[model samples]
Structures are given as C-alpha cells and as structure tokens.
Target chain A: MEDALLQAFLFAQETAEEDEGSLIDVVPGLMVWTFVTFLIVFWVLRRFAFGRIQGLIDQRRDRIREALDEADKARSEARELRDRIAQERQQAKMEREQILEDSRRQAQRQLEQGRERADADLRERLEKNREELDAENARLREQIRRDVVELTLLASEKVTGKVLDEDDQRRLIEETIEEVDVKRLASEN
Target chain B: MSPLLAAAESDFDPQHEFLLEEWIPLHLGPLDLSVNKAVVYIWLGGIATILLGIWLMRFGLSLRPDRRQTTGEAVYDLVQSQIAESSIPTKALHIWFPYVASLFLFIWVLNIIGFVPLPISNDTFDLFGVELPTLGIYAATANLSVTLALALITFFATHVEGIRYNGPTRYFKSWIPEGAPKPLLGLIVPLEVISQFMRLISLSVRLFANMLAGHMLILVMLGLIFIFSAWWLVPFSIGFGTVIYLFEVGIVVTIQAFVFALLSGIYIGGAIEPEH
Candidate 1:
C-alpha cells in the first residue's frame, strides 16, 4: 500500500510536469488588466445602471402610497356625506309627517265645532215654529165661539118677538164643554 | 465479454508497460508573463466584482428599502461599522471609504471563484506549444500570484492613505504617541512601521494560502479514487470530497469574503487614524 501511494504521488507530480504552465507565468498581466477592467466596469455600472433604477422604484412606491392615502380620504368623505344626507332625509320626512298630522287634527276639530253650531241653529228654529202654531190655534178657537153666539140670538128673535130666553141660554152654556188650548199654547211658547 | 477476459484486458495489468516519464520545460528569463487560465479567471473575478459592486450601489440603495436593498445595505453597513469605524477613528474613516470598499469587493470576488469549475486542458503548444490553444481560466485566487498582486495594491493604498491623511511628517510622528517613553519611540516606531508593512504579507499570504490549500485539498481528495485501484477506497474518498466540497461552498466562501472585506477596512482605517 505504501509503495502504491508513493507511486501515485510520483505519477501526479509527473502529470503536473506534463501540464506546461505554472501559476507564476500568467499572474502579472492578469493583475494589470483586472485592475483596469474593474475601474471601467465600476464606473459604467455606477453611472448608467444602478443609480436610476433604485431611484425609479423609490419614486413609484412613494406615488403609490400617496394615491392610496388619497383614495382612503375620498372614500371616507363620501361615506360621511352619504350618512349626512341620510340623516337629513330622515329629518325632513319626520317633519313632513308631523305637519300632516297636525293639519288633520285641526281639520277634525273644526268639523266637530261646525256640526255642533249647525245642530244648535236647527233646534232653535224648530222650537220657534212650534210656538207660532200654538198661538194660531188659540185665535181660531175664539172666533168660532163668537159666530155660535150670533146664531143663537137670531133664532130667539124669530120665536118670540123679543130676546127673553135668558134662562134657556144659561142652561145650554152650562151643558157645553170648555175648549182647552194647551197644545196651541205649547206651540206658541 | 466474459469476466475473466475483461480482467485480462484491463489497462493496469502487470504486463502492460506505461511510461512514467513526463517533461515540462521551464525557462525563467526576464519573467515571461503570459495571460494563462489563472489570469483569465483573475480578470473574470475582477470584472464580476466591479459589476457586482456597481449593481450593489445602484440597485441596492433605496430611499425606502426592500429585501434586496436591505441585503445590500446590510453588507455595506456591516463592513463599514465593524471594520472601518471600529478600527479607524471616526474622523479618519470617511476618507478611506472608496479605497476600503473597493478592496473589500475585489478580495471577496477573487475568493468566491473557487466554486467555479474551471476546465484545465493540456495545451502546452497553445500557451507554450505555439500550436495549441491555451489552458482555460480557473480559480485565480488558487494561485499565489494573483493574491500577492492584490495584497501589494492594499499595501500601497494604505501608505497612500496614511500620507494623504496626515501629510508625511505628522504621519510618521503619529507612530510615537505623545507620552511614550523617549527611548521606546526609537524601538517601537520602527517595529510598528515594519509590522505595518508586514501586514501586506500576512494579508496576501492569508488569502493565497487559504485558497490554494482548499483547492489542493479538493483536488487531492477527488484524485484519490483514481490513485487507489481498490474499490473500497472509492466511496471513502468520494465521501470525503463531498463533505469538503459542501463546507467550501458555505464556510470557505463566506469566511474568505468576510476576511477580505474586514482586512481591507482595517488597512484603510489604520492608515487614517489620528495620533490618539
């Protein structure tokens, strides 16, 4: 095993020989060019690429935030306005209903008062007409009594050339019933 | 295909003669530097770092942060608060932000390249063979060359920042605090300065060593299945490789990235600190 290991090492070293270049051969030129390229690349990247890209992304973010804030504010304001309008509409509706109710109540009271007045006027007129009818009936009864007396006087004169039948007349009047005008008085009162 | 015949036909039969000799030519004259696979990877890592850095800065910052922004900001903030602000005095830290940030990002990207499976082809003629295509890009941090270069940059940047902040005389004098024993300055200041320079070595070697060891460990572990001809060793080696690979995926990547950033911040912060 040891011999084999040594053999392998020898072969590896020999392979290194077969590979022509040493790391030493190429280092100086690599360094010079590496520095030059680094500077150029650094300058170009700084100037042309990264600066603007970062700035743009930041700007976009700012704008987006601003827009979002504005939208939120606008939405809140709209909601407030809507709420106010709703409240106002409710108030107006209530006021209108109150007014209508008040008018209706007033109209009902007026109608009740007018009905009472008309009923009172009709009752007074009816009482006055009843009193006039009673008065007229009384007057008509008196006239009829006078006409009956005249007829009795004419018959007594034809039977006996004088009016001397007083006893008979007294007897006749006592037998006749008195006419009571209570209904006619009631109408007059 | 009978089992006996198959066994006889195996390439590793004792009778078969396999040449064990292989030669790679190395001519070290005038430091011949070529853009090899590691170099390509280094470039890729560096480019990726810069692009990612720019993306983090540009796309990560927000007036109002989201998840990605928060994540990016958290990274920067973590580096800033823990490293720069804590290590360096607040007054001096701000000036080093760019340098520290750059260093942090550079190191992080280089360290992260280990996970990338780089294809290595034997093309001596391509890079050195003059006829074949070059070996392709792999993990650059796996090579000490790249990490050393990075550390050198950090070293120079730290000095530059120190000078820039305090102007040379005050900066050097700052090493000797006001009430230090007169003899101690002579001894301590030199040591402090040397140690400061030595920080670059530590930083470079730390990253280079870690990356190199981790890659080598993975390679060696995976290579074991081929090394041992016995079937029993296969499962063990594969299991070991898998565990290390998984750990590297998480711990190695995160630790390397954090350390790189932390060290960069510390370097810059130390440079600019006042004489407190």
Candidate 2:
C-alpha cells in the first residue's frame, strides 16, 4: 500500500512538472508544506498574539467605563451642592425678613406707649389748673363782699350826720349787717 | 546579450512563472519532502507575522499607545468585532477567536507578499545558455493545493465543533430539519451531504481563483511590453500593470483574507447551532 502511494505521488509529481497550471493537480508535498505552515502560524498567533491583545483591549474598555462612572458621580455631587447652597440662601432671606418684621413691631409698640403717656400727662396738668382757678375765684368773691359792707356802712353814717356813742355805733353796724343779709336771702329764694 | 535583455526576449508564460522550483530535496518512504519557493515564502511570511506580533506585544497595555501599538489594537478590534463576534456564536467566540484571527493574519501576510518582488528563476528556457529563463514573484495562495488545504482545515473544524457542541448523534440528526415529513427528509439528507462537500470546493476555489486571476492579469499585462517590444507600449503596459498590482494589493488582499476568515467562522458557528 505504501509503495502504491509512493508510485502515485511520483506519478503526480511528474505530471505536475509537465502540465503547468493544471487546476486538478494535487501536489502532495506542497499540500503538506502549506498545512504545516498554517498550523504553526495558527498555534503561535493563538498562544501569543490574540490572547494578549484581547486582554489589553478588555482592560482599556474597563478603564473607560470606570472613568465614565466617576464623571457621573462628580456631576451628581455638584448638583447636590448647588441645591444645598440655594436652600441655605433661601433660609437666610426668610430669617432676615423675620428679624425686620420683629423690629418693626417693637418700634410700633414704643411709639404707641409714648403717645399714651403724653396724653395722660396733659390731662393731669389741665385738672390741676382748673382746681386752682376755682379756689382763686372763691377768694375774689369773699373780698368783693367785704368791700360792699364797708360802703353801705359809710353811707348810713353820712345820712345821720351826728356824733354817735359806742353802743349806738354798734347797734347801727348790726342793723346795717342784718338789712344786707335780709336782702341777699330774699334774692337766693 | 545582457541577462535582462536575454530574459526579456524569452516567451512570457504565466504558468511557467508561477510554477515552484525545488530548493531543498528530501524524501521519506512515501513522501516527497522537497522545499519550494512558495514554501520558503510561506516560512518567511509566517516569521514576518510572528516578529510583527511580538513587537506589538512588547507595548503591552499602554495608556498612550504609539503607532505600532495602535495598529496592533486596530487589527485585534477588527478580528474581534468583524469576524469572531459577528459570525461565531457568543458562547463559542472565545474558543474560536484565535483561529479566526490567526487565519486572517496568515492569509493576509501571504497574499500581500506577492506585491514584494522576490526573484525566483523560471525553469522554462535557457536564456543565452544560462538555463534560468526569467525571474518572477508568485503568491502562495494562488496555488490550488494551498487553498484546498486551508479549506479542508475549515471543513474539518466545522464538523468537529458541531460534534463537540451537539454530541455525535445529535450532530448527525441535525442534518434533517425537525418536523419535516419522512419522505421530504430522504431528499433533504442527500442534498445536505452534497452541500457540506460543496463548502470545501467553494471556499477553496473562491480564494484560489481570485488570487490566481489577479496575478495572471498583472503578468499578462506586463508581458505585453515584451510581446510588442515597442517603446510606446511600455507606458501603457507598465502603467496598467502598476494600477492592477496596486488594486490587488489594496483591495483583493484584504477582502480575500477577510472573506476566508468570516466564512470559516460562519461555517463553524452554523455547524454548532445548525438551526440557521
């Protein structure tokens, strides 16, 4: 069988040499060479080239993904910080308004209290002036009454035109006084 | 005659240019262990890919990536999202990510190497009695055997993952849809088997045809310069060749690598689930 195969190979080789560019010709030697070459190439590339290159590519992809995730996290953190700052600013504005409102209310109460105290002082001064004026008017009336009695007594003396004893003078004055008191009592009735 | 003029005088054959010359000849009992130009380029391309990968890995996980690190990350991102995550099931992405990514890098490096001018001797004619006809550069993926082997790997991986995920019996049972009539299954089962095999052919041919066609078109365009031997044809031929070469390098190389990896992922993912 081996000898037959050898004869066949030799025959094919001879024919291939004669008929160049024959499509159906099978050159067993060349076939073996090509297969061996292909096998060596495939094995070497698989072991060394493909495996290492793939690992590097995968690692690069993983790094890019991690970087993207980190960027997203940073973006969210910045948004949160802005939101908190805005909230703080709003709170501060509200507190300022609250303090202003409290001060205004305090000023209003002070103004009202001052006005009330001034009014009460004016009222007390007016009452005191009216009471003093009444006392002065009552004293002035008693003085006018004493002057009238003196004038009436002088007129009685001028009408009699004579020297009078002490008992007589006293009787005259008492009579005059009783006549004045009778006239004032008739008017009051 | 100068070697260049001698090489230019020779007939330009695309097949002859692409054919591999044995570099190191060895043999086992039934195996031919001769290393060829394509095999050498494959080794060089593989080593270049490994060195670049090691250089990028040295950057580790830098916070500020330099140009090399950035490029490394970009490649990883493309494979992870475009191929693995998009095509494979979520649960199976981790397990299959390396295979899909490695496939993309390996194929891409191999495809792009065609643009770099590495001189290989054509065995067709003795130019000025020197035996070496002309020098040419060829992409390894342009060869059908290489593409076929790659497709076979995907094919085996798909079924292996299917069995691993769904168990042996369940994986086989998944060929026929659930709730299908027994009579319909008779038709469906064979079609399913054929379609699975078709994946192998389609995947292989798709890559093989695209690479081979692109390289051949450039070679043919450049050969026009030699065929005409007119100074006037140089501008057009060389210009068009350059344009096509740039297009292949920029567009074809990237799309082919991406398609192969994506299809492999889809096939494996489909096998695992089998519903869609």
Candidate 3:
C-alpha cells in the first residue's frame, strides 16, 4: 500500500508547474476517471457479490416464515384436542351419574320385594301352626272320652260284682257315656 | 519553525491540496487522460471498494455469520433497505441496487481517504540520497470535477431509464404539469427544463461543497497557527483543528456520501415513475 502511494506521488517539486484554476473549476480528465472508476466498481460488485447475498437473505426469510406457520398450525391442533377431550369427559360424567341413579333405583325395588315376600311367608307359617294346634286339640278330646269310658266300666265291675261279656260291656259303655255327656265332660276336663 | 514547515508555508494554499498534479501525462488528441493525484485516488477508492465489498460480503458469509460476514450483511442491508429498496421500484431493483451501493461506498471511501494522511504527495523530500514522497492528506471527492462527473452519470441514467420505462413522449411530458393554463405553458416549460439541469448542479455541488468545506475548515484552523506563528496559538489551533478534523471524518464524510447516493436514487426513480 505504501509503495503504491509512493509511486502515485513520484513527480516534481512543491510548485504546480502551471497555475491551478479556482476551486470550482471543472477538469475533464478527473471527471472521466471518476465516471469510469465508479462504473468498474459497480459492475464488479453486482456480478460477484450482491446476487448471492440477496438470495441467501431471501432463503432465510422464507425459512422463518415456514417455521412460524408450522407453530401456528400446531397450536390450533392442540387447542382442538383439548376441546375434544373436555367434551368426552363431560359425556362420561353424565353417563356415570345415570348409572349410579339406575343402580340406586334397582336396589330400592329389590328391597321392597324382599320385605313383602318375608311378610307373606310369616303369615302362611302362622296359619299352618294354628290348624295343627286345632287338630291336636280334637285328637286329645277323643282320647279323653275313650279313657273316661274305660274308667266307668272298671268302677261298675268293682261295685256290683257283675262279669259282663264283650257285647254287653260295649252296650253298657255306650249308654253310660251317652248318660254322662262325654263331649261336655271332656270339654270341662 | 521546521524547514519542511517553512517550505510548506511558502507553497501554502488551502486549495492546492485539491489540485490535480499530472504525474503521467497521457493525451487523447485534445482530451487530457493524464494520471494525476485525483485520478490515482479515484482508482484507489474504486479498487479498495471492490476488494473490501468482496471480502466482507463474499468470503466468509455463512448461515451462522461471523463478525466479518455480519458487518458485510449489515452494510448490505443498509444500502438495500435504506437506499435501493426505498428509491428504486421493485422492477428496477435488480438493475440498480448494486449501482447505488457502489456509488455510496466509492464516494465514502474517497471522502475518508481525503482525511487520512498518506505518503502520496505532490511534493517530496530527499531521504538517503533518494527523493522520497512525504505524507499529505488529499481527498479525490473534494474536487468539483469528480462529483460533477458522478452527477452527470446519474443525470443521463435517469432520463434513459425514464424514456425506456415510459416512452420518451410520456416520460418528458410528465415533466409539464397537467391542465396548466396554455398561456403559462410557455413559462413553465423553460422553468421545468432548467430545473432538470439544476438537479445535476445540486447533486454535484452538494457533495463537492460539503467535502471541500470540511477539508478547508481543518486546513484553515491549522493554517491560523502557522499564519500567526505564535507558540500560544498552538493549543487553540491544534485543539480547534482536531475538533474540525474529527467532525469531518466522523459525520460530514459519511453524510455527504449518503446524500449523494440517495439523491441519485430518487432522481433515477422519479424518472422511471414520474411523481407529478
């Protein structure tokens, strides 16, 4: 760089060999050089540098846009899923309550049926026991009449000294029981 | 005062720094294509701009960027987004983005080169029996001719693009306001023509004046110390000179380059799609 500068400066003494024009003076040579130099720089930069940099910038911008779009889509999908789950949970909750209500109603119906059946069974048993007791009382009454007839026969034999045959004894016992009103006597005993 | 300073004092003209000293004289009939200091600086600026752009923009660019690539992208973004995209239409961006970008960078490089003290000088001193060049500050952009040439390119390009986009009749016709009183057409037409030429003057002179003024201010400040030749003037002169120097390098150089490029874009764009 220093060498280049030195070479650019290699010339005469401090004095301008010719007088310079005013500060605003136009020089054709410098103008041409400026124009040409600018053109060269512009062309080189356009060809070699700008195209690729712009393309890369556009590429990065596109990637960012795509990423943002994907994020938005994912967010919406998550919201939808949450909504569906909430709806299903609500339906399940209603179904559960309905099942509990049905179970409770069925339990109440079964309990009523069981209590009614138990009451009917007790009534039937009580009627059966009362009939059995009446039958036993009738049977005891017959057995008492037989015992009284035998006792009457034995007393008659001991007091009068009569030895009655089978027909007479039967007749005598019959009459004696009739005269004694055995049904009433048995009732009294 | 030093002998070199004494020598400079004799030849001290603030405008001399902007003067082109013909080093290798080459004439094409009447046209002087001589290699001069301004020409050399322009060449240097153009070449450096190309190299710097390539290095920053092309060499190390990755999806995951390093510092060099990041800076390149930042510069590229600034030109593309701020200048080219804003001024040039979408249809024309492919053609003009690089153009405006190059213009900005080239002018900016030239402007900055003016402030930096380089070994390229119109004068030299003897060193070890050899005449060696001394360091001096010169900016090619400080010249009216250089800025005017740049403006001329833009001026021509604007009309060409305008004509090409909207046939010559339509493009030129758009310059005249619609439904103007036929009587006033005579006055308006000349004024419009003058205004079109004025764009060239304004564009060129704006950059030239700003760059030249910045340099002259710094030079004048330092020159005060030399003019008075007082020891006490050293602090004030150096202090003020340093301030102006910093101001020029920091703000003026960059803003001038930006304004020139921006105006070029606006003119070209307006030509293509007439605002009125």
Candidate 4:
C-alpha cells in the first residue's frame, strides 16, 4: 500500500511539471468562475432567502413579547379583582356586626321603656284604689253613726215614756257618740 | 452488464478524472479561459445552491413553517449561531454573515455534487457499435485553483476588515505579539509575515487535499478491479469503494465546508479585534 501510494505520488510529481493541465495546476478560468459564481450565489440568497428568515424570527419574537405582556396584564387584573373581593367581604362582615349591635341596643331600650311604663301604671292603679276605699269608708261611717243616734233617741223615748225634742235628741246623740267610739265600731264591722 | 465489467472494459486511469478537458476553448490575450468540467461543475453547484436556498427559504415562508422551511431555518440558525456568531464579531456580522453562510452552502453543495456520478465526461467507449459518454465523479473544490480563489477571498476580507477597524499601521502590527523583546522583533516580524501567508496556503490546501484524497481513494479502489480484471476482485473493489464513498459523503463532505467557513470567520473576526 505504501509502495502504491509512493508510486502514485512519484508519478504525479513526474507528470505535474510536464502536464500544463495537471491536477494541481492553477487554472485562471476556473478561479474566475468560482469567484463569480460564489459572489452571485451570496448576493441572491442574502437578498431573498436569509433576509426573509430574519424577518420571520423578528416577527415571532414580537408576538411572544406581546403574548407575555397580555398574560401579565391578565394576571394583574385578576389580582386586583381578588383584592376587591376580599375587601368587600371584610366590609360586609363589619356592616353585619354593626346592624346586629344596633338591633341589640334598640331592643334593650324598648325593653327598659316597657318595664318603666308597666311599673307607673301599676302605681297609679294602687293610688286610685286607696283613694276610693278611703272615700267609701268615710261614707259608711257617717251612715252608721246616724242610725245609732236615731236608735238611741227611740230607746230613751220608750223607756222614759216621753217624746224628745230636737235639742234633746241632738244632746242625746252627742252623749251616745261620746260614750261609743264610732271609728272602733266601723273597724269591728 | 455489471458495473465492474464496464469499468474493467475501459482504460480507467484513476488520475484521469481530475484532468480538465476543455469542451469549448476560449482564449483572452494570453490566458486560456476555456469552459471546462471544473467550470461547469462550479456553475452546477452555484445554480443548485440557489435553487435549494429559494425552495427552502424564499418560497412558501410563513409564520407557520413547513418541513422545508424548518430545515432551512435550522441551517440558517446553525450558521448564524454556531459559525458567524461565534467566529465573526457582532458589529460586522450583518455584512459577513451572508458571505460566510453562502460560502458554506456553496462549498457543501459542490462537495456533495462531486460524489454524484454525472454524464459529463469526454471519456467514452464503444459498446455494440454505439458510443456512450462515461458518468464520472469530480469536484470543483478538488482543484487547487478553485480552493485558492476561495481562500484568497477570505484572506483579503480579513485584512480589509482589520484595516477598516484599525488603521493599516495598527492592523499590521497586530500580527506581532505585543510587548515582545526588541532582539526577537527581527525574527518575530518575518515569522508573523510568513504565518499570514501560511493562512492562505493552509486554508486552500486543507480543503483541496481532503476532497482530492477522498476522490483519489475511491478512484484507486475502482481502478483496482480494472487493473486485475478478475471476477474475485469485484467484491473487494465495490466494498472498499462503497465504504470510502459513504465516509466521504457522511463526514468529509460536510466537515470540509464547515471548517472552511469556520476558519474564514476566525480569520476575519481575529482581524477585526486583535485583542480578541
């Protein structure tokens, strides 16, 4: 294999100088075509192909940024709504407690007023009953005293066999009232 | 008839494939600027590259991408991020990204096309009183002049960018390391100058040799069956040739194009910023 390679190399070395169109020979035409072709390919592809691709990449990037911004906006709005809900819940709880407190205070005031009114009515009824009983007691006492005086005068007339005059009757009633306590009699009856 | 028999029947000189036979002879002053196989292959490569680029990237491009568009985008991204972004500086990327990407696709297509057997050869043989053209394999990139021309473009672009960014005095001086001793200056300057020229040779020769070597190996393998003209040698010839072909197609073809573009980027980028 080494000898084969060496021979090929030697043969190439031998032919390279003699052959103007050898494998290693620098052909000017081929070089110019390569340069021209390469330049043209570079220009055409860059103008059309890569340019559009870069544009797509930029577009996709912008879309991704927009999506992220929208997501952030949505998240913030949701947070704000949640905070509002929490605040409302707290306020509602305070309002409910305040109403309950006010109801309890009103109920207490009404209960105290009702109790005072009932006591005042009971006291007035007691005072009126006492005054009526005192007036009746006085009237009964007067009737009983008058009946006793009349009986005393009739008994004196029958026993003494004489008719009493108005002065004698009055004198006899006074003497009987002094001897008999009418207040004690009325209390006993 | 078997492919081996046909190859054996012909006077198959492995080296003859690289030889450029002019189809139309055109002379300008003293130079023989003839239309030859290499020139034709270059034109084919250029045309195919353009067609591929247009079909994939230009036509039917939407916000919604298809398979072809996806592939094209992948290639573009690879070239931009991996090659141009890494090697070329950001400031000059707009100008040179297209240049480097075009160079990559152009050379890659040429290399791939070289492996394809095309009916464009002067070599012919008599078969049943009918002459038929031989289907041969050749690459424009295999030629020294072609690769040199490409390297020369990079070589000039590098220096041009360097000079453009930094003045000629500073750019040339950048080739020499900063704070070197005065006594070593004499040796350093010449070595640096030689190295600059060496970049041209290295870039060109690397591509030329890899392509030439792969093609030469396959040719020699095919040539073996013809030289021996034995039925038993057929299997070995076809087997080795197939392996080499596959290897070249899979690895060497893409690698050479990538390295060329990568090196071109490196050279141009290094020139733009000497400190970098």
Model 4 clashing residue pairs (backbone) = none
Q: What is the C-alpha lDDT profile of model 1 across B134-179, one tens digit per residue?
A: 3322356655556666677677877787889889988777766678
Query: What are the chain A TM-scores of the candidates, in order?
Result: 0.54, 0.51, 0.58, 0.65
lDDT of 3 at B258: 87
| Model 1 fnat value | 0.26
lDDT digits (tens) for residues A33-69 of candidate 2: 8888888887877788777777777788899889999
Name the runs in model 3 displaced over 4 angstroms.
Answer: A1-18, A106-189, B1-8, B126-130
TM, every model = 0.54, 0.79, 0.82, 0.83
Q: Is the docking of candidate 3 incorrect, acceptable, medium or high quality?
A: acceptable
Provide the overall lDDT of each model, using Cα atoms, as 2-decimal numbers: 0.60, 0.77, 0.81, 0.87
**Highest DockQ scorer:** 4
Ranking by TM-score: 4, 3, 2, 1
Interface RMSD values for all candidates: 7.9, 7.4, 6.9, 2.5
Please give, for residues A29-71, the per-residue lDDT of candidate 4 as tens digits: 7888889999999999999888988899789789989999999
Q: Write down the TM-score of model 4's second chain.
A: 0.95
Q: What value does DockQ give for candidate 2?
A: 0.24
TM match of model 4 to true structure: 0.83
lDDT leaderboard ranking: 4, 3, 2, 1
Instruction: Point to the candidate with the largest TM-score.
Output: 4
